[model samples]
Target: MTNPLKTQVLIKIDTITYKGHSVIRINIPPQKEISFVGEKAFIREDSSTVEAKGPKLLAVSQLFQK
Candidate 1:
């Protein structure tokens, strides 16, 4: 059987902790799906590829938000 559909997204923040953690706050909308794979993260929207980025996923997400 096919897996349930899920849309994922990674948000970009402008700050980070010294521990190398992302400080960017994100507000994911309902019905969207998101997942993080190591430094890279992936997001899907309505069964379509939305985004994929490295540790700096937020930075990339910001670009698309604009």
Candidate 2:
């Protein structure tokens, strides 16, 4: 049997308290379906959101075909 689909994202955000080594990690599993905003796809890098362009845009477009 196949696992149920989960399109919701799970982000892990850590709160810093004591001063020491801090780490930020995000786990984005492989996408089963692509989502768009205003007819464009955007990727999140750290704390920035940038539009996908060139080959990236092409790849995203292909997802619709699948």
RMSD of 2: 6.7
Tens-place lDDT per residue, model 1, 1-66, is 013322322442245565777576644544333444444565655788655656456665565564
Per-residue alpha-carbon lDDT of candidate 2 for residues 11-52, written as tens digits (9 for 90 to 100): 334445456866555545566666565577787668998889
Worst 10 residues of 2 by lDDT: 1-10
Error of 2 at 44 (Å): 8.4
lDDT of each: 0.49, 0.61
Indicate the residue-level lDDT of 38 in model 1: 44
| Candidate 2 clashing pairs, residues 3+ apart or interchain | none
- The clash number for model 1 is 6
Best by TM-score: 2
**Runs in model 2 with CA error above 4 Å?**
1-8, 11-20, 37-39, 43-49, 53-56, 63-66
User: Model 1 Cα displacement at 44 (Å)?
Assistant: 0.7
**How much lDDT does candidate 1 score?**
0.49
